[model samples]
Target: MNAEPVRPPAEAPTTELERADDGAAEPDATEQETAAPEPAQQELAAREQAAREQAAEPSERETAEPVPPEPSKTAEASPAESVPTQNLPRDPARASDVLVHRALPLIRSGELGLAEATLDRAWELDPRNPQAMAGYAALYVAAKDGDRALKWAKKAVRRRSRRPQYHVLYGDALQLQGDVTGARKAWTRALSLDPGNREAKARLADTSAQAAK
Candidate 1:
């Protein structure tokens, strides 16, 4: 029968000071002063000098960097981003239509000046748009500016020649302006464009009778 040999683990390495600390006390101060060489003292002085240089470097750097000024409350509150503009849809919803709808709220609130300004901007954005001219024409009529109403109505008709409503508006403007013959002609044109146009038919008959009389 054979038995395997058991080996203890190897011991960790230890410094000379640590080995001495196990049981032996350090040398007395008088003994150290007599035994310690000048070279050791020079090394100790150099290590202290290096530590002092490291500590002084950080303080010198802190002094070199100037303190930043405190920020004003107004400066912090100033907006860094711009306000977004709300734009109209580009599809079948025309700019003129959007302007008209937007102006309605102002009109309802009796903000006629703002309503007119909105309509004016709409017309400027789309000068050839029938709806824009129609809105302006209606506004002029409501404001009792017959001359501007007639001008805008005629422009609306000229821009959308095939629209019966445009012709009807022109006829109404002419009627209001005392041009009975011209009104009858405009209404007749509107009726010819749309045979079932009730407004044009009624207006045409009324104007014709008035002219005959």
Candidate 2:
């Protein structure tokens, strides 16, 4: 026997070596499987960092003081409250004068409804008040209601015949009604009561010039 040439026990079968290599490769695969979660972990960390950043920022309400609301533009003062101390009348007799003074601008500005309401209130405050009656007469003249203007004008003169302004108002109402003679007499009476009455003087001049024409 040739001493049994044992070639290293036939060098273990090639298939057995291949099997060992395969076994070694299994551990590398397991390591690769474990490392696969690193990308997912990085994504999760990125999301957590973004959440922290957002939480660190301040909100508008938390960063600044709250602003107060502005006052309303349409807020109005009460009639009594709106009147200044100087505008308030000293007595009941002058109450209608105060009201008329306040209403004139409103009437001129085409706020006739408001002026009427104010004059009505003045009348309620002082019934048969000369100034209130005169105010109504003036308002009716502005509205082109000649009958009502004449009626209120007569009432104003009846209430206070001595007041030159009342006679002037009556004259204006009479002039609106085409009563030229009546207007002239009323205006003449106003000038007699108040010699320096510029309005009465101007009206008399106008009436006399018209009569001459």
Candidate 3:
């Protein structure tokens, strides 16, 4: 015959202590959980995430990256660059001479208004310029204003007493004003200043011949 394993004999539990032990042992709910409590676990995870972000992120106001300084929009200019080189201040006398030279051609062309305007600007630059005075004299002579011409010619002679050209201009103005004696005296003075003055010689010869007649 085959032998069978012996087992313990069954007995019924009837006492309170025996009954409690005999009932199926209930598993502790707290021991059954694999993780911590829900609230504590969530709080721990939030703290870990915040710590990771803080370590990885840079400060908002500061950085290790190099940034170049921007150029200023209102930087000061150098003295030479700040001021214009063109149209610098010119000498009044030289500017006056340029204007007077421009006027003489217009006078010869009988553009009296334009000549007078230009000479006026020259005079404004240099009031005592003898060339400017002589230019005015020529302009009035061309315009047939004998008295004005005489006035400006006299001013020219007063300004430059030794220039024979100015003396010739004076004599011409005197002749225009019908002052024959004054004109002859001016021509004689011009001849004394310049022995080679053909205009003075011719004028004297013409007047002497007229007087003899």
Candidate 4:
């Protein structure tokens, strides 16, 4: 009643051959992996070396040296550090004083433009110069610029009140502005300060004559 399982001798031999073939194919794949191309590896190494060389090379700017600074004239002239002096009146005033004095003759001769040019130079040299300030004030007054004349005259008076010419100039400006009382008071103050000031005396006489009219 029971049937027995049968084994084929030919089939067993065929299964053994197939297992050997699989083993042989695994060894061939291993050989192929070991024999992979070396050219790509060499190229990668060469590129890395080239990058390192480029990083090591000096740039155009780094190789060039810096230019030295030029020597200053003042530094060469003196070894010791010098102190700056305040602008004070020169013991005997320079050509600036002469220029201011010459401007007066131009002003007297009715050459306002020439007088103004000289005074401008004199004031530039000595900014707080009384004579130059007064001369410039007078020039401005002659040019009919009362505001500038008053400004310069005030500066002149502030610089040197002993020079009564500045007060006369201020008085003249006040007179032009129709402030007769203020002009009279300024002229009176100028005369009181410098009793022998010829210009102040002349202006006071003119003011009195004009007021009487």
Candidate 5:
């Protein structure tokens, strides 16, 4: 009987440097793979990083916030602003006082013609009164008579120099007559006399705005 021949396994390929360098053997591909992750593993990591960034883009956009709008500015109001008016005298206790109470309301209500006639009756009763003089000035102001208002307002303040309300009336008359400087002085005087006078404070506030212009 005849027998068959057996062959050994083939050797791996190598170059001069791969075979030996300074008496040390170069590593085979399997040994290199065990020593460190290289080209193939690095390429796979780069592809996964790119995929993760792409997948996160839509969620990042959905979580974004919009800016809100700002509020608009408005004009500031005056500290002592109020209706143009005078405090009515205490309930009448005299003949002339009865007319003052009646006529002051008429003047406030804009009935200048009737108020003037009623004021004439009060004038005949007590012509020297500062209250009557201021009332007359206010009535003339309502009547749109700047000259008359100024005239009577001046007389009223002169008649009662210590009265803050009379000074306030004088300021109103000065403003109506286009004497802004005089009006400021009158209001300033009123404040010096009675710092808590609200109408004087209101008039001065308006005067300050006018001066700025």
Candidate 6:
């Protein structure tokens, strides 16, 4: 019994008690390193999810269907269009006659400017018309521009030699320019064209009286 002296069992290893009063246990270096990467992994996963969502979304131009262009309002003709087919083969002679008729009232009312403007428009409508040229001659006669009157009157006579009015207007211009003989000849021709022409008779009488004077 003395040789086998019993030795007390080795005291059980005692674990150190963690106190609540002290701070929580600090992680080891290896644990801290591993934990630091967890936040980065989560952030990387979040970024990847956001990228996936962005890639799935359609762009504005791609999402919207192509819209057709609206038809042009100006290009399309209206159903009730007013086409001037009546004047398609424009009769300058007829147009000038109508204009002269319209302008006569204005001339008689002493609206010389307006009459002249209307006659000018008539000339533009029918430049070669005898009536338009005669109108211009009459306007110049009224304005006391004897030279211009004679010029236009001669043109009218040349264009329409058979017109009694054209001969009469030529006689008037000649009278204004003091060409008594020429006026008498023109008025005589007018009377020959129309025997009952009062204006030609009066003009002839006046020319005869002037020659006697």
Instruction: For each candidate, give its TM-score against the true structure.
Output: 0.49, 0.55, 0.55, 0.52, 0.54, 0.55
In lDDT terms, which candidate is top?
A: 3
Better of 3 and 4 by TM-score: 3
Off by over 4 Å in 6: 1-93
Query: For model 4, what is the alpha-carbon lDDT of residue 115?
Result: 76
Write the residue-wise lDDT of candidate 4 on 96-174 in tens digits: 6776887787778887766777777676777767888888888887877878888888888888876677898988877
lDDT of 6 at 46: 96
Model 6 residue 160 CA deviation in Å: 0.5
Please, what is the whole-model Cα lDDT of each candidate in the order they appear? 0.76, 0.83, 0.84, 0.76, 0.78, 0.80
What tens-digit string does per-residue lDDT give for candidate 1 at 1-213?
A: 889888788887998988778878767999988785689788999999999988877576577978799987666422212111148766433766787767656656766676688777666666666787877776676666779889999888888899988888787888778887888888889999999999999997776687689
Poorest stretch of ten by lDDT in candidate 4: 77-86
True-structure lDDT of candidate 6: 0.80
RMSD of 3: 17.4
Order of models, best lDDT first = 3, 2, 6, 5, 1, 4
Query: C-alpha displacement of 155 in model 3, angstroms?
Result: 1.1
Positional deviation of 108 in candidate 5, in angstroms? 1.1
Q: What's each prediction's clash count?
A: 0, 0, 0, 0, 0, 0
| Cα displacement (Å) at residue 27, model 6 | 63
Model 5 stretches with alpha carbons more than 4 Å out: 1-93
Q: In model 6, what lDDT does residue 141 have?
A: 81
RMSD of 5: 18.7
Q: What is the total number of backbone clashes in candidate 4? A: 0
lDDT of 5 by residue, 177-203 (tens): 888889889999999999999998998
**Model 3, TM vs. native:** 0.55
